[model samples]
Target chain A: GAGVSQSPRYKVAKRGQDVALRCDPISGHVSLFWYQQALGQGPEFLTYFQNEAQLDKSGLPSDRFFAERPEGSVSTLKIQRTQKEDSAVYLCASSSRDRGTNEQFFGPGTRLTVL
Target chain B: EDKVVQSPLSLVVHEGDTVTLNCSYEVTNFRSLLWYKQEKKAPTFLFMLTSSGIEKKSGRLSSILDKKELFSILNITATQTGDSAVYLCAAFKQGGSEKLVFGKGTKLTVNP
Candidate 1:
């Protein structure tokens, strides 16, 4: 079975540019999550989607970050006006059940560098 | 704010040695504690503990949770070079929605 997958393993963008990262969750996963990991630090929560509905966005650091999962299986995390501080790994995870029921399977992640 | 703290940010051990990693957390609506192993990329799930006093074991890796202490410990016995990786501890919270709060992670270096 295929695990969660993220596109553009690496991306470099100029400051102020907009970038979009894509994630393809496992075939039947009903829950998806996004997280940001800074250098030498742990991954911080970004947002979560249960199916096509955005359940939580509190973890998003700023208004510049946006995510959507219209179809419920694939998701996109878009960053507007990239900053050097945005340079890090964007991880996507999916789980068969909602939180408290099962563990999440993570994707390889897309490493973004803003210069 | 929710926080998960791991001890000994970094450790180095030789093969055949046993290593224990500690994780303590303080968060609202704590549901479960999880452990992950990261190797240069994404973290893979290791263990998820929801009840206290129960030990979860998988081969040479084992974990025990103490809900009263708000902590958990992961032990790797007879460590091998293959065990070298960053070990991450996370606390799952189920409030309005589900979220996994993480610690800075512990870098483990197992040299043969």
Candidate 2:
């Protein structure tokens, strides 16, 4: 794909139900990132991957929010036991370079609703 | 902890009017600042400022950074209804983290 691609544009999950969101970054991009954006709020960083390495998961709000990029290209963000507070738009981005002033390209994002 | 704050959470302006959005941040490692324009879905990259006093411009949008003050501003001149959207500001942390700390964002609505 020419840009980052996200699966399941919209998702509705019952409380305590688990959900998984997938992201396919641009071809050959070395860096991938996941962010969560609440209504009317900016996208908050959740995790970062350099190639297949999960380098940072500091911005994840809780232990239930887990992300992985197994093959260094496609990534998945899994939420265990969904809560109403977890409702938000999940964004994925990728950068061609691994370091030094690289510009990130973003995906359309997945809107998750927890009820 | 670290935070980024944007002023005038929402704004309404007539077409052809100019607008300026502000962003301030308090972070641990300040490497660069970025501006993005979001419409219905994804946010499109606008500008990235790494040094103080230099401005980045594209079409009718412009932005500048002030490393000393830990702030940045985005300006849109001769705005149109098509320009209405949410503007986001993000500060990049230094070192190898490569994470972006973002502000709440400014929603601009241009009435025709």
Report the number of the highest-DockQ candidate: 1
Tens digit of per-residue lDDT, candidate 1, span B35-57: 99999788999999999999999
Best model per TM-score: 1
lDDT of 2 by residue, B1-112 (tens): 8899998899999999999999999999788889989998899999999999998999999999998999899999999999999999998888877888889999999999
Looking at model 2, give its docking quality level. medium
What is the Å distance of residue A57 in model 1 from its true position? Answer: 0.4
Worst 10 residues of 1 chain A by lDDT: A95-104
DockQ of each: 0.77, 0.75
lDDT of 1 at A84: 96
Clashing pairs in 2: none
DockQ of predicted model 2: 0.75
Model 2 local distance difference test score: 0.93
Q: DockQ score for model 1, please?
A: 0.77
